[model samples]
Target: MAAQFATEAGDEPMNNALWRYALQVYSRPGVESLLLRLQDEFDADILQILAVLWANETALRISDEALNAPDYLAWRESMIQPLRDRRRACQRGEHGDLYELLKKAELEAERYGLGLLWTVLKDSPAASENCGLQGLMLLCNSEKECRELLQLAQP
Candidate 1:
């Protein structure tokens, strides 16, 4: 299911740009660890954070309503979270192959989730250049962590 959506999503300019930005930024030093820490300690939604950051970079606006869209929430809770939980539960030494597969699936689920976010966010143009930053503030609670993400997200 996710593969099918991902294949189609690749054809969309917005999806391609967002996914590329996410992959590039996430591969940077400290980004993966920082995002995981935010998820574990702050209950942050990594996909939402990435989407907001992508919007900011591209000067697109993601509204609060789009951030809390019911379908996106449902997908995250039902698909992404469970895969993340299962992946985290499996010890790499004990179930290395299974763990790797689970991790890949989780990533795909997240990619699909980003596509979902883009569907709504595309319609809302940014009123100002800082709209993405404004949305990020609403999603992130800790100023320090938010700053850290911003620094890492920048090329």
Candidate 2:
């Protein structure tokens, strides 16, 4: 699948860009647990958080109007959320294999959703020359929490 989006022989495919971004960011120390906590406790959208991080890192901005766009919302509700629910539902069950499969599906759905989001924001202007961080800060309930998360995202 990665080959489908590759521009050069050794390049990472743009098709899996979001997945790759997610993997790199999530692998940062303390990030995975922090994201999970935010999701489980605050009902936060992990994909949205990731989108914000990606935008900030890439010197792009996702406008509120784009984030609330009807088509994106529809896709999230129809495609991403259901897979996430199914994956989470299997967490407490004895079906380890099924759980893993659902987890993979959910991640795929998230990557697809992110791709759709990127398409929407592709031509949008950058928030600033310095790469604004406010988009990601807004994802958290408090400044302190947002600060912590942002720190983790730092290279």
Candidate 3:
């Protein structure tokens, strides 16, 4: 996230929007409530981290039936109003997490002394299009973040 991961080793700036959007999506209707109840800062950095976890987790839940429903896609779109870009990037590709992609990407980056590499993950990017498990990651994240999101849904 922009806050936590915002700074590189030298401490430069990155896209705060990604972090902000991350929280917006990460919080969702119920999750945000939990974070708020705990008095957590609604900043972008933490939110982005949460969003990343949420997006990755949700992408893993889609099934063939869910893939064919328009209404389902719409609902998913609604909940994930923010974090759309990162969510899409994570989602794109095949149906499996290709360790090869991650390895290749990371390797490619390191080739230039970039010292950075992100393995290409095989994802269908299905969630970006507005279908599949809507806000499905509404359940996954660090245990603490999960508890907060869960609390947000309290009656």
- Most TM-score-accurate candidate: 1
Give all candidates' CA lDDT scores.
Answer: 0.79, 0.69, 0.34
Total clashes for model 3: 13
Model 3 stretches astray by more than 4 angstroms: 1-13, 20-23, 39-45, 48-155
Could you give the candidate ranking by lDDT, starting with the highest?
Answer: 1, 2, 3
Tens digits of per-residue lDDT, candidate 1, 1-155, equal: 21232334445633565676688889999999998898888898888898888777766667788888898999999999999999999999999999999999998998888878877665666556676556777887888888888888877
Name the runs in model 1 displaced over 4 angstroms.
1-10, 13-15
Q: Each candidate: how many clashes?
A: 0, 0, 13
Candidate 2 lDDT (Cα, whole model)? 0.69
Model 3 residue 38 distance off true place after TM-score fit, in angstroms: 3.7
- lDDT digits (tens) for residues 1-155 of candidate 3: 42233322442112232233343554477655554443344322223234333334334333333232444234334433333323345534562464445544432322211110011111334344422123323223345654455344322
Mark the 10 consecutive residues where model 2 has the least summed lDDT. Answer: 2-11
Q: Give the alpha carbon lDDT tens digit for every residue of 3-75 in model 2.
A: 2222223323236454566678899999989888888877777877877776666666677776666776888
Off by over 4 Å in 2: 1-16, 91-93, 129-132
Quality of model 3 by C-alpha lDDT: 0.34
